[model samples]
Target: MHTPLSDQLRILLGPVDLADIDPGATPGAVSHEQTEDELPKLAARLDDLQRRLFAAAQGGHSTRRVLLVLQGMDTSGKGGTVRHVVGQLNPNGIRLTAFKAPTEQEREHDFLWRIRRALPEPGEIGIFDRSHYEDVLIARVRKLVPPMVVGRRYQLINRFEQQLTAEGTVLVKCFLHISRDEQMRRLLARLDDPTKRWKYNPGDVDERALWPEYQEAYRRALEKCSTDEAPWYVVPADHKWYRNYAITRLLIEALERIDPQYPPGDYDVEVERERVLASG
Candidate 1:
């Protein structure tokens, strides 16, 4: 069941303005300190759910999988979410992909071709740090594709996601919403911290300059692609602890809803037990 807090952060299939969400706001009664304190328990629950799902798949009793798509501006904490929120899961059951600019061969095919290839198998959880939304997001913001083409890709994305759901994949798409000032602070911190300096990309500054355009691009993509099969949730991300807590709760709700169960053994349990005992 979704908690009231998860319900609060979800973006319904309709219009939404990035301005309406307060990046610094923590939902309900939860504070940053409270979220941090609660995180380990929530993460443990997530791990158990993932183990169940993976076990069911291993037993050939489950065909369902989860795909979590995270989209946000530079330094909006997608990496942090992956590390803190999802890092607890068994790596064998998780497929994490961080997308960058398409390679020459990827560009030669439809945008979703590469994305389709990376989807999780049955009972696995797939996480995309950035996803197919880039076809409409960066592609539109930077004029990498024509406006009409970008518009068409939106419909294609919707249809593709519909197909995914129909084929037994559950999709959770989150946009890590952070303020421009917050983004700047994070970027500056990256530059100042020697250990984090490797994460600093020169292109991030150029992309930051076009913040307004990217915001508009995201707004349009959210409106067009948010659907029954795969809804987009805009998570307040300026407070990293709150962000991780909110997402962890959301995923727990989703997994509980899925309710994956272990399969009964095909052979006779009594007979198997007797044979094993005799052998020992």
Candidate 2:
């Protein structure tokens, strides 16, 4: 039997608790294996839920906006998650932004200036491929900024997210939790496949050298910013199919919670064959 939306959502919204998982584990290394036959059913269920969300969003006015932030180490499937999980959303109401290293002009401004510019307008959904959390993740991992400044950014981010939620944005942050082994598997695949060679970067190896520091950075980011208004859901990314299913399920629930409604209208009885009843 297919799982109910409420139960699926509960599992999706439950604590990520990465501390309990091994740092060096692969995506599916520790979890129970799923049978290949189960994938089609799971995919179909996600597609059905996504269709409902789109219908609700088309009619409902209460859903102001949704901002989904995706953060993870290279090969953790941030781009892939975006591709599969939200692939079917109504494009007219969605925006995707990918953040990279700062330009000279961007470097001159405050860290958040660019981020603020990318926020979606009311009634839209914004997906960030990488985000301001870069301020904490990259800066902390490489010591690029002062320790004091970096440490303070955590609370600043929490307050910033809370303010966004207060103002009508629904924020969902996801950290793709992939084990080192799974990362290496993906990294090697990138190198080995000619079609995927474009994704391989020498800098990835450099980052792998500082894996421990990145792990600490992620730990602190989750601990500090997972708040009531904008919480983080760390999806286990070893099994790409499961990761996509989990994220899509969570998003459908959030959209449903908004309960979009159609504008009121009356049927035109004069144009219909059936007789219209007179109002009292």
Candidate 3:
């Protein structure tokens, strides 16, 4: 029997050292071509599930929703994952937010306020490009917040997530794990290819210098926040295709378990069919 991809890729509650995992290794599957072949079928399944979820909401049958939190380094394919993976589902069924550095107005509110505002509506899929976790990941690594404050934020995050879960949000948290060497290579590729050159940022190189600090920060966040209600999965992301495939599989599994069925119409199907036929 085949193991579920989530079990193979999920970060079990424990200490997480990014250096220990191979970013290029494909988890639970064999080849890139094999994954490529499987993507369309997976995408079709997602399309049907998303539509059913939306239909259930429109019929006032369910309040359940999904929030996909994507956390990764600069070149870890977070945006690419959105474009290639979550992009498979219907746009109407998805609420996407690419959280950049907070603005002055955003800085005035609690960190989670902006996060809450961007949450998915009932039965929709919310995709966070970089999420509230940055409060711990980047904030801790750069000393943007006091150590005590950072410590407190972890507990607060746990509570905030639990609150979300209690309110019918199913969280799918993902950490796109990539090696330092792979990051450097991708950043350089951005500079080399004219099409990709627009994405090149000198600041990313500076951040790369603090790789060890970032790694430690990520480890700390993963350990502190991988709660049972909403645990994080570490996607080995040097292989972009596998990252997309694995995440797609994870989502399908979650939605299938939810098993949202299309709600029945209020009026008889025969009546609607006769009315349509008569109108034509």
RMSD of each: 1.5, 5.5, 1.5
**What does candidate 3 score on TM?**
0.95
Candidate 1 accuracy as lDDT:
0.87
Tens digits of lDDT, candidate 2, 37-66: 554665675455444444455555444677
TM-score of 2: 0.79
Models 1 onward score TM values of: 0.96, 0.79, 0.95
Encode model 3's per-residue lDDT on 1-280: one tens digit a residue. Answer: 3478877777788777777888998888788898788777888989998988888888866988899999999999998999998878899889999999999999999989999999998899999999999999899999999999999999999999999899878888999999888998999899889999989888898998999899898999988999988888988999888899889988987787678888989889999999999996
For model 3, what is the error of residue 114's alpha carbon versus the real structure, in angstroms, after optimal superposition?
0.3
Model 1 CA deviation exceeding 4 Å by range: 1-4
Q: Select the stronger candidate by lDDT from 2 and 3.
A: 3
lDDT of 2 at 78: 89
111-196: candidate 1 lDDT, tens digit per residue = 99999999999989999999999999999999998899999999999999999998888888999999999999999999999999
- In model 3, pairs of residues that clash are none
What local lDDT score does residue 175 receive in model 3, on the 0 to 100 scale? 92
Q: After superposition, how far is residue 267 of candidate 1 from its true place, in Å?
A: 1.5
What's the C-alpha lDDT at position 63 in model 2? 43
Residue 274, candidate 2: C-alpha displacement in angstroms? 16
lDDT (CA) for every model shown?
Answer: 0.87, 0.74, 0.89
Least accurate 10 contiguous residues by lDDT in model 3:
1-10
